[model samples]
Target chain A: MKPKYTSLQLFALTALRVSIGWHFFYEGFTKLLNPNWSSAGYLNDSQGWFAGLFHAIAGNQSLLAAADFLNVWGLIAVGVGLLIGIFSRYAALGGMLLLAFYYLSHPPLMNASYSLPSEGSYLWINKNIIELFALWLVFLFNTSSIIGIDRLLKRK
Target chain B: MSNDAENSKLLGRRNLLKALATVPLLGTLTYAGLKKHSNTAANNVEVLNALGFPKNTGLSIKPGAVGTIIHNNNPHIRLGFIGVGGRGRHLMQCAGFAPPEYVQDWMDKHAENPDDNRYQNFLEQDDLNVSVIAVCDVFDEHARLALEAASNADKKGQKDFKGITVKRYKTYQELIADKDIDAVVIATPDHWHAPIAIAAANAGKHVYVEKPMTNNVAETYELKDAVIKSGIAFQVGHQGRQTESYIRAKEVLDKGVLGKISLIEVTTNRNSPNGAWVYDLHPLATPDTIDWKQFLGNAPEIPFSPERFFRWRCWWDYASGLSGDLLTHEFDAINQVMNLGIPHSCVASGGVYFYKDGREVPDVFQAVFEYPNRDLTFLYSASLASERHRGKVFMGHDGSMDMDGVTSVYVDRASIKYKDLLDRNLVNPDEPALTFSSATGNIDAITSPTAKYFAKRGLLYTYRDGKRYDAAHLHIREWLDAIRNKQQPSCDIQQGFEEAMIAHMATISYREGVKTYWDAEKEMIVKGNSVKM
Candidate 1:
């Protein structure tokens, strides 16, 4: 038996999910609106180990073009799924995985340029972890009992 | 009945949550208000956009009509000059330096020629003349160069400065005692300004002392007394006061162009330590002709280090750290435009985060000055690792004018929308247009247009006929002209003392770690440790 959420907890989950979904969906929509845009400029400017990966990706313009399209589609799909509360757990897991790949690729927190690793990198608590936990907690509780379209559809 | 009780409880909880949400918003508003309240002025002129109201507006002056145009050479008193160093030298060869007579004349002839090299070359030369002057140091090298440049004015065939001769002085004392010299241009190092100024005033000669008036506060009072007693003409070298852009800014503010100005922020950005204040040490900075004793005059006596003499600004002993070097210029403009003489109190906080070359002066500093009456606050700040902000921003109740030495006035456009009473609620409520980045294109519509318009307008500046002739040339002209006509110089001794006092007080405040109050009547610091005076 799973514990059910109070109305406040349900509202908090819904707000977080919607915010994350919109953030991604907006990013995708903007890129789609401007088809000439690419990550090539940023990749060229980038240095260190990431430089190799960026160069490799930028070299195959056609393949990277497809990847760019997929990246936008993936963001929109994940955002809609989370916002609708349909496949919410799966969406959260996929979002985390995608973000982790980016986090590893760029690793803004890890400044490899500095003499000492501890002196350089800025490692604050990642928001992805918080969202991941939120997703798990939502899965444990029965959100269908709360005030959402999910609950209405189940009742019908 | 039972349902009503539950409904009331639910309503009460909702109201409590709303109240909780209001706390941060209220806190932010109050913080901003407090900042504004701290910066009010004593006069009727509210601190409009941190820059005061434009003193005078577009009452176009018809040529030769009342207040329209004063002949540069029409002044009853002529100017005589002494030190022709960095600023002094530029003033000397103004005609030859840039905007050559040929260029200006050519521009007038070919007014439609935008693509001509003559115009671009003219602008370039005009900018070159504004290079910071280097007056004679203890050594003969800088002085020799200055004299060479001063004498070369004749070679350029400038007719206005036909008869002025360049005279070199091995020592400033020799130049001061000369009978023909009526006024002196003191452009020595930061520490030497006060003693030389006092000596000049006491010797019955008027003075045009450069910016960062004095090294400390006590000298300010001494210099003030000397000038007052001598009754000589004195002009503080805040050239910005005589510029058109700053004057125009004052006019725009006075007209309530930005509505009731509230917050003023002045910022300088440098991405490197040297850009901030790192003085490069020259290998040849020895105590021989370097005048180590003279350089450290009233500053705390320490062992003769070459760095201390050459790059005195980096050390506290030879300079007022940051305040004297940069803050003086900002304060002078602020005071001139806003008429903000003395602040009620000032609190500053910052540290030297870059350049670990054992320099004592803070590399970065931010200080807030509070004034009385309507909320008027002056924020002064600088950083070595970033370059986002500029010299100053005067924020008003309605709009803000972002300004600095480079840009005269940058008015925010969102402020313009406030004129329509019906549009009051629509300002910040508009739906933000979606973009690839967080940057909304609408904000660009507000800020960039004005920047472009102002850029095209360029500098609308005019100098007195003999402007930038050479310190000695101008000083000599003023002196001889004054002697011939029995009149006063442009900047009298008293004015020099007052300008110098601002710098002195700034140094005292930074040194004592307290807000040093200026007693204008007594011309001394009213509170804190009584320094030298």
Candidate 2:
């Protein structure tokens, strides 16, 4: 079957995926090098319906430690997989899940209170959810097969 | 749909299956890694437990015999006084042991104003079941005055005090050795605090020592060991522990109202000379009346100077200056509310820029204590030269707490995370938010304009049934009740040790001109490279 998308469209989608991958990779890398860094503070500040769940995770040392490990390593793994276009679909799914967790924790609901400053105002759809859907589009298009390592692997 | 598009979708599903197949393997690897990390975390917890980390004590207020008259069911506790100076006299007044003359003078002064809180508080002291049996001081003036206050119980119109014989001793050792004295209140110079306290503990007498607990780290451990070994009820005079605002702050903190506090700023400011510890020297303090040699004890031998005797807090030889004298109060109050113990490291920098009266300690000081484990930092700043007050503030992720007489919790306005709760009215908005204030109208000590402002907002004292109570009196009553019940007081030996160690870290950092770390396991200050002081 012939590919449907034009080269420019494929290029744009690949660029979005790689850029988002780099963002995730840098965040994970910085946290990895910093011994004192933890997500506990962010979790503790969680608001709205899932606040209790987030607070519980923050309160339990074991759970917090586990979250720290998974969040950091998962970001790095998903970033690498997406950037190189190897296992791109799985990475997209994983990235969507991570972003979903962040979005649910804070939930860009209207009029909710939070200590941290927001990048932009939103009722339900914020940057996290926006990027989450973008990742979904990247997965659906299978942009990796067009211009990523997946293409070479498939050819081999 | 076209046959080519359907065929392409089928191809995409095939590719997705291949990508999904690798995820289970990645999941397996992640699970193994987490298992190894959990074991390491368990070991870390064990180590923390060994170092007395993760304090579990909760705030539980046990009301003592304050504001109530006690029937003489048991024999009164006989208390001996050591260094009957300013603080000692105040404690005596709190214990209802002030001489009849002193009470009469106080009452007479407040006679025109029948609603004076100080006068009322002083009157309430008459019901305390304690008697000053012996008084000791290096200064004859202080000892003689204390003796007069203790012995003269026959003043007209004051029928609560019955005339009791009081003995005056020249030395604390002699006073502590007295078989009739069951307890001792040591309010001597900072250098003499631990020595008298340790001796009194060894002599089987309970002790109430003033703050900073010890002159140095070595004495801190020595005092702790002595009190623990003797099993006496030792109370460090951090009277702010009884402050109602702090007690309520603890309650709010326990509720996680201001979630995950990471930074706290504490401060002290005073504009007056007396506030800077430039206390008045007694006119009668002559070499003949004062046992200058006995007062020197372990301090550097010097000629009889009334300045050193009266303003001991100005010099390092006898006192810890701002860190011990003032910072301890701030630290102890925060510790009571937060249960924050010793910091991992501290860096202090300040100088005696204002008062240049040959003082060994600085008049302006600032210290930063870092607790990496808890991801928190405490900053302390004090200036005796300025009257501008900077109240304590605790910064958390959800909100920040500004603690004064009236503590306030402010939520974050720019928070996206709490948008849902705010919209649903589950939490109050940033403006016109929740606030807590004392029920009592006002109390004494709100003399300053700033204090009056706080008082107007009900910030100062804790109130019960529309009446305010003195924190010092409550603290003293707690100590006495602990003495009667054989239980540890609020600021016990362990608390005193931590308070002294942290306060000393600030002092050492400022004096030595270096950063200091608390070696929690060994319980000692680890000094860094020295800089110019």
Name the top lDDT candidate.
2
Write model 2 residue lDDT over B1-533, tens digit each, in one string.
Answer: 69999999998777665434334433454455557555544543432232222223312432232222233325578889898898998787777756666766667767865433355566654456677889998887777668877775443234555554688888888898899998998889999999999999998899999988999988898999999999998899998876666666676688676678889999988878998999998889899988989888888899999999899899999998989998899999898888889988999989989888888888989999998888999999999989876889888876677777676665555445445545654444343133335533211111223333443344334654435556666677777878887888999998899899998999888888889988877778889843222
lDDT of 1 by residue, B1-533 (tens): 99999999997566444324323432453355445433321211222222333213312321112111222333333223344434455544442332134334556555664333344433433221211122344644445545544444333323443432456565667767777665566665677777888888898876767667777767777887887788776656655554333554565566675677766777667786566555566555566646666556677778888666555677766666667777776776766667676565466667778766777777788777666554677778877678765646777655555444223333344555344421432222131110011111111111222233323233211223312112233333443344344555443444445455555555555656776665545645655534322
Off by over 4 Å in 2: A1-156, B1-75, B115-117, B152-164, B420-432, B440-460, B464-467, B529-533
Task: State candidate 1's DockQ.
Answer: 0.03
DockQ of each: 0.03, 0.02
For residue B169, model 1's alpha carbon misses the true position, in angstroms, by 2.7
**Candidate of highest DockQ:** 1
Q: What is the TM-score of chain B alone in each candidate?
A: 0.65, 0.80
Model 1 bad stretches (over 4 Å): A1-156, B1-88, B91-136, B156-167, B272-274, B277-289, B300-304, B404-502, B518-523, B528-533
Clashing pairs in 2: A111-B419, A112-B418, A112-B419, A112-B420, A113-B418, A113-B419, A114-B415, B99-B149, B405-B459, B406-B459
Give TM-scores for every candidate, taking all chains together and pairing residue i with residue i.
0.53, 0.63
